[model samples]
Target chain A: MPTLSIAELKKQANLIRQDIILMLERAGSGHPSGALGMADIFAVLYFQILNHTPHKPNSPLRDRLILSCGHYCPVLYATLARAGYFPLVELKTLRQINSRLQGHPHNLSLPGVENSSGPLGQGISQAVGMALAGKIDQAKHQIFCITSDAEHNEGQLWEAIMTANKYQLNNLINIVDCNNIQIDGKTTDIMPLLSLRKKYESFGWKVLEMNGHNYGNIIATIKQAKNYQKGPVVILAHTIPGKGVSFMENKYDWHGKAPNKEQAEKALQELRQAV
Target chain B: MPKENKNKSTRDGFGDALLALAKKDKNIVVVSADLAESTRVWKFAKKYPARFIEVGVAEQNMLGIAAGLALADKIPIATSFAVFSPGRNWDQLRISVCYSKANVKIIGSHTGLGAGEDGASHQALEDIAITRCLPNLVVLAPADYNEAQKALAVAIKHQGPIYLRLTRQNTPIFTSAKSIFKIGQANILQKGQDVTLIACGALVYDALQVAKKLATQNISVEVINCHTIKPLDKKTILASVKKTKKVVTLEDHQIHGGLGSAVAELLAENYPVPVKIMGVNDTFGESGTPEKLYKKYGLDQEHIIKNIKEII
Candidate 1:
């Protein structure tokens, strides 16, 4: 597969960020911090990394992506549309009564969504099961799970972490969005996670740390993590909440709050000027 | 003529059927949270080592993994004690499997006082109540070994989330191979008009025993095995009750939310009949022998017979 160049990927990520701001503004209620923080990773995953056929979303041979933190579904919806899974016009009906784009990711309602998730800490475990199935069947498809840093507060996350290493799931790659801002305050203030690198290392996982906002860094780090044969690989990607929007950047207020028309305009303007 | 009574735990029947189901369907995988032998899934784990996944002492993760495997087109049978799967990981079952519409078969073994000396924490008296409330989740408590085997076959073919609640104790296997089994359909073992005896799980056999004792006293009784708890067999239940006008509902679960409450709920709205709900009455079980626990908890045959006399 010919990879998207870093310039092209950056443009895609910018376009994705714009869509996130637009859809969240239109929806009137959604999470912005993690969605904006994960735009670059989503772009790299769909365009440059994932072995998926967007046309045939349920193709048995395609790779699977399980979104653990579902409140940030705007990022997943935007990325799927950008990847040709659905039309971009459908993005306007997000959070509407009859729209397929649910407030939380519902796999049965939409195509290309591997599993339904909204409640945190379950997606990682689901990815383990999918990865374990691939290993048992000797399938080549990989399973990637995306989670928020604050969602680690759930005890089930540690349960999942233990199961992944215990089974030595080589086909599973976890991408953690370490934006450091949760709903109410900073993660350190709410609940000090201390060092995630040491935590994963001690769990017998191959830990890869990289800058999530950088397109080149995302591509390089994910490529390395996928090829990792030791055991389960968890990539702790450092990022800023609400990246590119100066007002929202690093602010925990935007973690679960959607932008109004004025804020959306400013965020879109910044994204358009950069790419 | 009565069917042969095979003494076997419902958990063993579940394990035996799973082994056979896995043979035909290659996608059938067993996911356990370190209760393989106790839950009777050790056979499947031993026979199909590659197909079995043991997530040690992690019920929440076990459910998530089962939901994930179902997404990948694998029919995952997640096994654990009733207190854990629907007990500890109900949210996972609700959000991951039930709400997601994943094809996950959850076997909650050692239900009711079948957990025996494991005490209150291990007993899953509230499992049916919790699982029955979840949308798109089918709940089953097969009576004996044969019904358990047949119920699993029915659950596997349903293609959605189904909770098969099993017990640890050996009960009388009255249902034969030829006995008809269908989801949401109850089979009336005997016909009478004095009163109706509706039971599920380990208490189904005891209900039959009490029905026989009531017969010699000239008090006619009708016995119905309500194995499928969620989609109550309203047709069969109402038909029996309309003739009798008095009902005695029995289960190993608390009288609040198990089979008894379900029957009372159905009858109260449709046809207000005087129903006596016999089981654990608004309390928890303790550590004791299965027989003593049943007797003390008002689930034994004598208590059931007494309850029937009061209702009549």
Candidate 2:
């Protein structure tokens, strides 16, 4: 597939946000904030950045996209569907019995999911392993681990950070969804990770910062990460908890709960107008 | 019994097999979590420096990394102490390795109450129980050096996940070097009639000693090496129990969720028989010599013999 221009990517991202709202509304229970928040990056990744063929999801030559923040799988499902991995109708079956689109992604059940994640902080470690394997085989494919902010509290994530650095995983790129809101309260309130940039740099990573919602910024930062060969690079993509809808934006209340039917309609209306 | 027996740690077999696998297949990579030397995965690390991933002291990350390596079509042997890997990283094993069905061989070394003086903190008494319950996982508790080596080879060839429990102490090797190993198949070491001594891991040797002593009194004892713990070899276990009519399960693990529990559970349902479980009772172990700890925990040859005598 040809790379979608920034304007086209933005439109695609907005569509993904709309799909997220619709899917969550139908599912009756799911995390919405990160799903809605991380749409543009997903759009940029699946449409512009990744060397993936939706028809052949497990292609060895394809770049591996690991969703460490599995709660945001609605966005992944929506993006994977839009990219022709499966039917767009499957999005409606989110969290339903025997649906491939699980509340958390399962790599076995679904074609496009690189790793299964539910319990947090494991995705990055798995991604690091994939990166190391790629390096060992001299493969050209990159391994991108998309993680969230509150998940940094997981000690294993830091452990994986050190391993990635120790291996000098140049093909490994970590895109942290640095949206400040976590379930219960603000990330600072629940568990303060004051400066993730400093934490990454301290672990010997070549850290980069990006605006997660901006298509051009996400694309550019990712490109810069792809070019870095010194060691593993982490792009701390700062995102709003709820990006498109007005009432939900930056709200921690939207962190773990799905939008009701009325709320979904309103969010979709706002999204359609905004688009 | 073999005329020349070479007493060796089961971990030696683990290290040798890993090195052998890496030599034959470049896809076989060894991952260590700071316990490489103890687990003997260090041999492969030393041989193929590039193939070894040293993930320092983090069992959780080591498991996740191994899963990732499997995703890239590389067979990764992830190593750590049993108490830490299956003990602490069960969640990682469940989701990352088992659920993903990643071709990752997990070496849980220094298992059971046999790790000697390091105390209860270092020993793993619940690895079999913890690992057996997991879906898409192959749990193997090899009886000796040869069996452990054979189990590792078969586990590597299998497409999905396998967890092999190995011991740190130099155990008395009983099984032959030429014994054929297959997943879910039990080896009937010494056959008799009056009673059956079902065992696994280092305790398999203890069971043999118990069986030999029982033979002096003219009580025929059948010895079984139940190495495959998860898919408990129901055929071998049940068939032995049917003839013997009395059973004694032995292991260096706890009475619950180990070899004994599997045997008891199997017998209780299919064929009801008097089953005596000889293992560390539901309690933590303290620091001491292997002999003292074994005696204290009722996991020695004397204890197995007593339990079998009572049941018979």
Candidate 3:
């Protein structure tokens, strides 16, 4: 497969956002704010960044991706479906009883999911393990772990941060969607994350700051992270809580709210034109 | 019956096996939580720097790091005190290693009262119970140094989450290096019919001594080294129970949820044999020598003998 260019990646991001909006609308119960917020990063990773094959999801040589913030699973599910990991039709059965697509990302149930992440602050640690495993196996494959900035409040995330740094896990790439809106209120009011970049940097991680919604920046940062051979890399992506849709973007209420049929149509319409 | 035996710590076996495994397969990585010398993973750490990760003083991170390494297809053995592995970073172990079903070996050194002076804080009396409860987890508390080395090798070969519970203080080495060790299969150390003594960890040697002592008294006692605690060998247990209606379970862990409880649960559900559990019976141990703690807590050969008599 040819590597996708920045422009092509942006187009794919727009399509993924379309899928996320439509999937959530069908599920009638899913996270939208963080899903939309992570759209661009997901696009870049699936289309260009990761060395993966949808045909062989468990190929030992393929780069591993773990969705730590599983609530934003709609985005990952949409990306994986669109990437031909499974039929895109499976997106409709997400969160349904007995469906392979669980509310949280489950590795055993779902192909291409490197780790199961439901409770906050677990995926990153699992990803850290994957990266360490890759390094040990002498595999060139990297581990890309996407997490929510709000999950930073969890002590386990900090524990993972220290481990990743201590091990000098250069093969691991942790991307945090720093949208600032959590479930209750503003992240600052709930719990201030004084400086995530500095915190990770102090823990011996190579830090990268980028606009999460910017396709070019996402590609550039990931490329930069690939070049960094010193230690683990954490990309603090500044994104809107709800990125594309005008009404839902940056709204705390949309954190886990699914779009109704009418709301879904409106969300898709707004997302299509904006991107 | 001979009382004094050549003593060897299970942690030493872990250290030796890890180094040997690393020599054979460079993919075998050992991660320690600042107890390298204590847990004996330091031997591997010294030989294989690339495969060794020292996550200084953080059990949670040690587990997370080991899990991450396993995900990448490397067999990682994470070593720390038992009190910390299952006791402290249990959630991490469950979520990262067991739940994900990663190929990671969680080595908990200095388990039970055998950790000695570290006392209740360091004595992981609950490791077996806690680790066994987690689904898809391989919980093995090997009896002696030979079993520990074999268990480590076995864990490396198995493609799933494993917890190798180790001891701090040196205990008697029961099985010879040539003894074949397989997970989920009980090693029958002594054969008899009067009663069965099922035990694991440091207590297995003690059970063997008790069985020998009971044999001289014309009381034939069966001694079973119940090494793999999670996948408890029900066939051996049930078969022994058929001959000997009474059972005495010994462990250096808490009597409530350790090997004793696992055996009792199985027997209660299937055989309905009378069982006397010999362990730290529902109490925390204090700062004392391992020998003193064992004698006080009724975990020594005498204690096993007494417990066996009570059950009989």
By TM-score, who's the top model here? 2
What is the C-alpha lDDT profile of model 2 across B1-53, one tens digit per residue? 76437788899988887777778898999889888888887777778999988
**Where does model 3 sit among the CAPRI classes?**
medium
Residue pairs whose backbone atoms clash in candidate 3: A128-B68, A129-B67, A129-B68, A129-B69, A130-B68, A133-B69, A134-B72, A242-A250
Q: Is candidate 2 or candidate 3 better by DockQ?
A: 2
Off by over 4 Å in 1: A1-3
Minimum summed lDDT over a 10-residue window in model 2 chain B is located at B1-10
Please write out the lDDT profile of model 1 over residues B1-312, one tens digit for every residue: 267676998998888988888899899999999999998889888899999999899999999999999988899999999999889998899999999899999999988986799888888889988988889999999999988999998998998999999999887788886688899999898889999999998788888888899999999999998999989899999999999999998888887788888999999999998999887878889898889898888788889888888888
Q: Write the per-residue lDDT of candidate 3 for residues B1-312, one digit (tens) a residue.
A: 233458889999888888888888877878888988998876677778877887678787778777777777688888888888878888888777788898888888888888889778988888988999999998998888888999998988999999999998887776878788999999888889889888888877777777767878988998899999889999999999999899888888888888889999998999897888888889998889999988898777776777777777
- In Å, residue B78's CA in model 1 sits off its true spot by 0.8
Q: Write the per-residue lDDT of candidate 3 for residues A222-265, one digit (tens) a residue.
A: 99998899999999999997777888988899998899999999
Candidate 1 — which pairs collide? none
Estimate the overall C-alpha local distance difference test score of candidate 3: 0.84
lDDT of all predictions: 0.90, 0.90, 0.84
User: What TM-score should be assigned to candidate 1?
Assistant: 0.98
Where is the poorest 10-residue window by lDDT in model 1 chain B? B1-10
Determine the iRMS, in angstroms, of model 3.
1.8
Per-model root-mean-square deviation over C-alphas: 1.4, 1.2, 2.5
